[model samples]
Target: MEEIKLEKGDFRKNIAVAGLGLIGGSCTKALRRTKTGKIFGIDIDSGVLDKAAGCGAIDDGAVDAQAILQKSDIVIIALYPRETIEFIKDNAGHFKPGTIITDTCGIKEPIIEAAIKYLPKNVEFVGGHPMAGNEFQGFDAASPELFFDTNYIITPHDRNSGEGIRVIERLAALIGCRRVTRVEARAHDRIMSLVSQLPHIVAVSFANLAVGEKDMSVFMGRSFMDVTRVSVLNRELWTQILEMNNSNIIDRIEDMIDILQKVKNALSEQDKNSLQILFDNAVKGKRMCLY
Candidate 1:
């Protein structure tokens, strides 16, 4: 990978963010730290825009997406999955030539494909996903340190310009992310399906199994709490993620079910040898994840 060249106080382009939720608000807060340029925020929800302004995340706020994009040198598409694609199509013409666009959407394959089709020829759309977030949602949950020491993945298409990619890396560094990796869009979705999407599914499933049971409260313990902690995440966002990456997620879930069935058979038969093997293998596999 080539080193990105950026100097302190060198970035002087106005930035606009097309959403004022957790991801968008966090971008605003991070940009403020750089003292680079004026930040404008846009949201369909006026309440969210007002809240972002109140939090000092942006210099100005508006409900019109085009109006914001018109004045921005760079635009961050932080809307939900479906809305993100639509926003690009609806406002592509408003962007200045050579304006760099990036997104914080979780799934990349579908979104990047759509961007390639609908985005203006002069504008660049690079897919970015920061591997850090809390279960909480909304602007109130946004923090300036959200990306600190986190891994940020940027997936660029074939048409992406070299300079455009550098702009994104600089933005990630400005947000305090210490590590950045570049990957293809499809590869990103597949890898995340196993590491990120499957875990959320398992957490939600575990939580649901314990709900509405007469004796469930008696069996609750710290182990259950630790495992189901992320089950408290916003349902709307998780639903979008699951649906967007349904095929990859389903394949991963099937593989997990196979492992669970093996464990169940070992326990039911009181097979001590099988149980010990499973425990030892699990420990070894988990230890490999420490790096």
Candidate 2:
């Protein structure tokens, strides 16, 4: 891990973002808005490439990542966790020497392991997860402002150089992230299981209750809608994420079930005091963690 310095006030580097989905498209759009280097967009869909190019979000577009990888100083692999790993394994040799590759994958441990096993020694991999997004998917929902005022997490392993970490931090800031936090890869997954993955599971489970009900929408309120917003998820993508982080997610799910059981017990017993205490504890928890 040698120190490589970027010129002050001019850190423009050739950036390639592989995948033109929501996060990838947003990254390309933000980099373009900031005039940060030559940006190349890559996706399997030619229509997505055309859309991104038409919107001026990318300087160039391509289906093949080989040429882009060979020229890019920084490559953002914004794909699903397993797909991201496969992409690295499939194109390990194409990366430019000294290229810094970062990913926007939800789970980090597997991706980091894949990089360690498959990536060229000269190439560096930084694990990143932007703490932002809506219940939307694909390029059409992408926005340059998606990262604004959001937190970005970067998990660097022993293989990463200080210079590569700094470059990623700068890129996060350039894309309007309000804060950039460094965390261990496993620890990041643990936290995400509770704060992120668990919520989606809860939403999906709750939303599923409407499946057999007739005129369900007529009874839905803002509270139900708010709680279920994330239930409209990309099923395949979430299946991959949840499976990759299953251990952590399972623990959180168990905790969630225990809490829900407590509420159910209190209501069944008609114990008003117990219910009020539960509500009070929830209020305190929200204030402590979220406020």
Candidate 3:
């Protein structure tokens, strides 16, 4: 791992992305515009590859993971947390030595742990989570501009080369990310468990609570709707994510349960002062947020 300095001209490199769903498709589109080298879309779905290719999002498409792994200087895997691990386990040996790899998976520690276990020493597998995407699924919903103004988080393994991480940061910037922040893998997972996974759980739970009310949607207001919008989720993908960051997520949920019990007790006791305190604290906490 010698010092690898990236220049504006060095932005052109053979890049392959696994999975062409929202994040992958968006990356394909963005990279196709910015990178001078070949952009390959690797996936099992020929239809998706065709769609991406037809729209100029990818230079070519391949179903063979090894083919892409062997050819690309960089690989961005946009698969589920577990699937990303399995993919690396199966294909990491096939990656050209010195090739840099990254992912768009939500949880980090598990993926980073699994990657380090399986990836070849010469290959750089930097655990990454591009902080973007919406409640949408599939390539059709992908916008090339999706990464614009969004944060990208990268957790480089201690075993990873310094140069590889720098390349990833520059690559993130080239993809239109407003900021790229590096965090320890465990810390990244811990924060994502509270900020990202817990919200989805809350949104889905909120929707689940409305089952008894058949016309709950009829009276839906902005606040409830806004909070539950992510309830329209890709459950399978999220199931993997929740499990990957299980311990951290469970800790946060336990904290939530504790606070909720306090709120419930205040309501049951008809304690206006206690209820007002909770409401005021929540407002103050929220006001501290940037957006």
* Candidate 3 or 2, higher TM-score: 2
lDDT of 2 by residue, 1-291 (tens): 222233555547899999999999999988887656689988999999999999999989889999778779999999988889999999999999999999998899999999999998999999999998999889999999999989899998999888788889888888888888889999999999998999898899888998998998889899989889999788888999989999999999999999989999999999999999999998998998763
Cα-based lDDT for every prediction: 0.86, 0.90, 0.87
Q: Quick one: best lDDT, which candidate?
A: 2
Query: Candidate 3 at residue 61, lDDT?
Result: 89
> 180 in model 2: Cα distance from truth in Å?
1.0
The segments of candidate 2 whose C-alpha lies over 4 angstroms from its true place after superposition are 1-8
Which residue pairs show collisions in model 2? none
Question: What tens-digit string does per-residue lDDT give for candidate 3 at 143-239?
Answer: 8899998888989778978788888988888888888888998889898887898899999999999889888868989999988989978988988
Clashing pairs in 3: none
In the range 46-148, model 1's lDDT, one tens digit per residue, is: 9988888887889898998777777888899888888888888888788988889998888998889889999878889989998878777778888888888
lDDT of 2 at 123: 91
Clash numbers, per candidate:
0, 0, 0
Q: What value does the lDDT take at residue 66 in candidate 1?
A: 74
| lDDT for predicted candidate 3 compared with the true structure | 0.87
Q: Give the Cα error of residue 55 in candidate 1, in Å.
A: 2.8
